[model samples]
Target: MKMFGLRLLLTVFLLVLLELLVINIAGILPFIASHKANISDAPYMEFITDNLQHPIESSTHMIEEKNPLFFLGSGAVVLFTIYATFFMKGGKGKYELADKYGVHGSSRFAQRHEIFKQGETVGVPAKQLMKDLEASMLVSKGEK
Candidate 1:
């Protein structure tokens, strides 16, 4: 469980770093947009720049919409996180041992029926059949 938590944290950190790297490479860094209005321009150029003051905002929106790689990476991370949380159980299944031994659900019922059949064939009570089976199992294990 501790290992799982660590893996989940590492996955989130790597995904965040990937997002930041993608945003930087796309030249849509949020700091640049937030600070664009603080940049100084020549007084004579200010008149022409007034119409362009919101260009960074518009371009950032466009980049966000058009950047397919960013969306793909984000989606992959979300899917992987969900899979890790819900499906991946560190190589163990919910019924791993039960399934391996055919000891769950219909299989368990089938095993009981098989034991009943064996008891009937041998003309013995269920308790005697069970004891005989147990003794045989112990002998087999000792032989192994």
Candidate 2:
């Protein structure tokens, strides 16, 4: 299971990395190619064009080139991938973050019909009451 999760994470990360590379390359190609004639003349534009034209060198290194938006977008992808790779897993158990705080647990509910049969309140089963500490505490505290 752990291996599968790791594979899935790696697959997603690679796909995103590829997507960012493709988009960056595609997006800057036109700008650089269109301005190629004058790119060599403008020092700042040449620098910007070169930076934008390069692929991401490493996970920590990013070349925004000319499109800051695409650079930021790629950064977002990297952040999300890192976060998911470290934190997410494939299972309903992953959604149990709420359980960590004790928001959910064993619980029992009495049917309304069962509770008010013939217009009289029926006592809930003791086992169900014990599942809820509030009910048990109420009974015990009353005696004290």
Candidate 3:
């Protein structure tokens, strides 16, 4: 739920766009059905019969308004409600938690580095993990 707001915005935009596409396609099918004309050597309008989208506006009428934007908006709202409520959530922040913590954090949380080399700590734990190895080893020896 980190980017819940962003997700809602994107989902709403996409769903509304989808609704618009469906509605427009429903309205525009007749024009596509009509302009069965095409380009071909077989005279005016017979040989190229199978060709789609003639792009002529002679007999095409404007898209009819069967479904209003208000209804479309309402439907989009319902869709978004369903989406935001349950559909997209992934098992209670499974991926979100994994991503929020650095990817290396999950695997390696070094606590008091026991610097082991060649199967042993060489009876020491500080020198190898330090930048100034000689000084660190002396400090470790002094501490011991």
Q: Pick the candidate with the highest lDDT.
A: 2
Candidate 1 Cα deviation (angstroms), residue 144: 36
Please, what are the lDDT tens digits per residue for candidate 2 over residues 1-144? 999797787969676665555455545555567678897654555544554465444222434345555666666667776666667765667445553333346244545554567857657798786777676787788953
RMSD from true fold, candidate 2: 14.3
Q: For candidate 1, lDDT tens digit of each residue in 22-83?
A: 44434334434545776453242442243245444533654666756545655776776667
Residue-wise C-alpha lDDT for candidate 3, range 24-124, written one tens digit per residue:
44434443445446423324333123222331221122223333443454467667767765587556565556544445547645444334446565454
lDDT of each: 0.58, 0.59, 0.49
Backbone clashes in candidate 3 total 0
TM-score ranking of the models = 3, 2, 1
Measured on C-alpha atoms, candidate 1 has an lDDT of 0.58
Clashes of each: 0, 1, 0
TM-score of every prediction relative to native: 0.28, 0.31, 0.33
- Candidate 1 off by > 4 Å: 1-8, 18-65, 92-144
RMSD of 3: 11.1
